[model samples]
Target: MTRITDTRDGPAEGARPGALPVAGLLLAAGGGRRLGGRPKALLGHLGRPLVEFAAGVLRDGGCVPRYVVLGARAADVRNRAELPGCVLVDNPGWADGMGSSLRAGLAALAATDAPAVLVTLVDQPRVGAAAVARLLAAHRAGAGLAAAAYGGERGHPVLFAREHWEGVALSAVGDRGARAYLRAHAGAVALVECGDVAAPDDVDTPEDLRLLD
Candidate 1:
């Protein structure tokens, strides 16, 4: 496996010795390079920062030991966002792409013995808590990998078991993020239909921002 720099430093909380604590890992470090370099975490979403909204989705969905990875105007995000209990991890290589943020989130979860991380993106406001809840159900049922599928197409808020975190991290390059890893193990991925509960629209470009309006 390729060795990346340590993107995390502290221990959040230890999971029970026999239990697999499921954590909420929000990848909010995107700089929104295509969106006029605005940090997605600080983008307005229904009168609040998108990071807070994204984290709420995870929290309300029943994920414990929540952690948010931040970069690209990290200090500004901290000062403005209302992230009360989330562990804020800074990914120095965030400019490189989403891979770093994903890695940072998993690294932080690993420190606490969290067997799995329910991952979400800050720009994806349409993926609601129901979608995440479905994935959580699959994880608790012993699915090593799970993702919300919209019209049979895999989308964000994926779940990764502890055993596969390293491989997923190693394969997470550029903005692809776990795609190649999941592709290679496609047969093992549990797909949950989320179209009925949520829309997988993302706030990538200016037009996508209107979803929050």
Candidate 2:
């Protein structure tokens, strides 16, 4: 792993000025099977691509060196979305499930100077920057593994300290996407309630498109 120089400005909470930056890993390679084979990353939200909004949330939350996994019409997403300053990773096996994208993101982060990673999904348009910030705050306060929760239920935008990246990558397979790892380490995960700040709505089938409205 190459020790990339940390150039992130305005270090986020828990990310000390001299310490490594926290990576924002966006898994946006879903093929949107239920949405008539449309790619979730290209779904429109707030007059822009869904990936744009999702990536913005991570950026605004203070995550540095954002990485977005692309699959299923990856070219279309790259051309249509204005994701400046974000590293795009291609996951050839994206159709296999979210786990592949998560693994790819982790692999990319492993080569960087990020100490932890905040993982978000492109289909989740409602989970915003506040929820991401809360998770980072939890990490800064000594929580090694933290996740955004809604009504006491674990949800997206999970934060994984560098120490757990390898484990998460290993467990990430198919669509489980860290479910096994998180479940095994449930006792250590800090569930930060974010229901008030954001909704865990997912834009999957046509019915789910209403969420973007």
Candidate 3:
């Protein structure tokens, strides 16, 4: 069973009054087979695990209830990282790929009744808090579908309203992960430009790791 630690919200303490509060859903379960089974969540960035940087982005961007989906090597991650205020969700089907983690993260939000969720990938350290804030601001401004656009190209850290959860979950198959769903609703998505503030370079191959300082 997926354990949702820190499930209590009560509007999540730090949310400003009248602000459109949303949960931050982090897909951090990748086993990184491409990186020889190294878990992406545990990858060191800035002397801290990548997950820590991601959570900071969400919090700084005003995401109320933060949820992190951990899969491959989940136990080791829990032991090595300090995700103090995040809801740690275990994705049993994580071996299947991003789709499983995506489903698990969203399902964990069932009881929170969050108006929306902002989803981000753990491997994109360069896609920092600033990009997240841009997408979050769009959500606050009532944009149902939003994402950080780099040079007008759609990318990660997408925001989906409450009503679109089911659709996203249904289409989140294999490693596609909301890609098909977002493509289906392109017109509805509000592209927030963040190229100036951040980049969405994912740390996948060893060479990509060089992007991190």
Give per-residue CA lDDT, model 3, range 1-213, as digits (tens).
787667444546576766657899999999988888899999998899888888888888778889999998988988888886788999989999899899999898977868999999999988888888888889878799998899999998899999999999999999999999999999999999999998888888988889776
How well does model 3 score by local distance difference test? 0.88
Q: What are the clashing pairs of model 1?
A: none
TM-score for each of the candidates? 0.90, 0.92, 0.95
True-vs-predicted CA distance for residue 207, candidate 3, Å: 1.0
- Poorest stretch of ten by lDDT in candidate 1: 1-10
Candidate 2 Cα misplacement greater than 4 A, ranges: 1-17
TM-score computed on alpha carbons, candidate 3: 0.95
- Number of the top lDDT candidate: 3
Number of clashes found in candidate 1: 0
TM-score, model 2 to reference: 0.92
What lDDT is reached at residue 2 by model 2?
Answer: 14
Q: Candidate 2: what lDDT?
A: 0.87
Write one digit per residue (lDDT tens) for candidate 2, span 1-213. Answer: 111222234534335657776789999999989999999999888999999999899989989878889999987888899887788888888899999889888987887878899999999888999999999899989988999999999999899999999999999989999999999999999999999999998888999999994
Candidate 1: which stretches are off by over 4 Å? 1-19
What ranking emerges by TM-score with the best candidate at the front?
3, 2, 1
